[model samples]
Target: MRRTWLATAALALAAALLVAGCSGQPLSEREKGTGVGTLLGAGTGAIIGAAVGHPAAGAAIGGALGAGGGYVVGNSLQNRQAENQQTQGQLQQQQQEIENQRQQIEQMRQQQETE
Candidate 1:
């Protein structure tokens, strides 16, 4: 039983690493979260299932639930990040416009002084 549990754990770790390394490009937050969640959930589920004699089934169910939850959280974070970036862009643009106006006002002042 101890050997079986160790083997299961090893297999889970290997699977997680494989999944994590499958992508060459940088993973999005959602993808990273999903991978992490799957790893954690599967491991936990395997342990629980072993207690009840159904490790594989437990792992599957746990993985699915974890993936869903992780995706939701990651997606929310991604959306917030996008919103913040957009807000920053708008602020920068507004600052630029204000500077342009200041420059124009200075030019007018110079013209008036010249006249």
Candidate 2:
């Protein structure tokens, strides 16, 4: 029983090492996207892979999805930054209008008092 436990522990450690080693490399945007894709794909692939008798292929498909996804994410972030600037401009315009209205009301009140 002890030997069996030791073997299981060793196998678990080895598996951890393999996964860690696979992930230890530096990640570029494309690679990062691909790796995430691979993982996400793998989860889905595991089901499909099991049916197809090839989980690796599933991981590959996921990697493709991830790469595409990452590209989209990068583009989206850029678009959002541009939108933020436009929204900020609009917010400023609204604030200025509010301030102008307040000033106009104050002027009208003063004119009534004088009359």
Candidate 3:
């Protein structure tokens, strides 16, 4: 019983450390998802494994599956965000071009009026 408790605590601490290690930079959606998933999975797995007398194996398997699932979801979100940014950039460029054309037309009109 004590051993199981210690194992669970160690796994939790390790998971926390893994997340803390990534705090040096702003985490993207994918990274955040992966961290969250791994932590949740490990904790849950440990509980379930304790019932079956295999906490470590359960934690390892759960963590791996969680990470993979998190990555997939996070990757999709990242791609969508990138697409949105690209669209916004294109719109801004078009707006700038329009403004430039308007300025040129104004200049042409001013020249004609002076003539």
Please write out the lDDT profile of model 3 over residues 1-115, one tens digit for every residue.
Answer: 6567557766775777677776797778787677778777776876888789888777777777777887888888988999999999999999999999999999999999999
**Candidate numbers sorted by lDDT from highest down:** 3, 1, 2
lDDT top scorer: 3
Off by over 4 Å in 3: 1-23, 50-53
TM-score of every prediction relative to native: 0.76, 0.45, 0.71
Provide the overall lDDT of each model, using Cα atoms, as 2-decimal numbers.
0.78, 0.62, 0.79
TM-score, model 1 to reference: 0.76
At residue 1, give the lDDT of candidate 3: 64
Error of 1 at 66 (Å): 0.5
Q: Per-residue lDDT tens digits of candidate 1, residues 14-89?
A: 7866776776767777877777777677778777877898887777777777777878887877888889999999
In the predicted model 2, the residue pairs found to clash are: none
Task: Show pairs that collide, candidate 1.
Answer: none
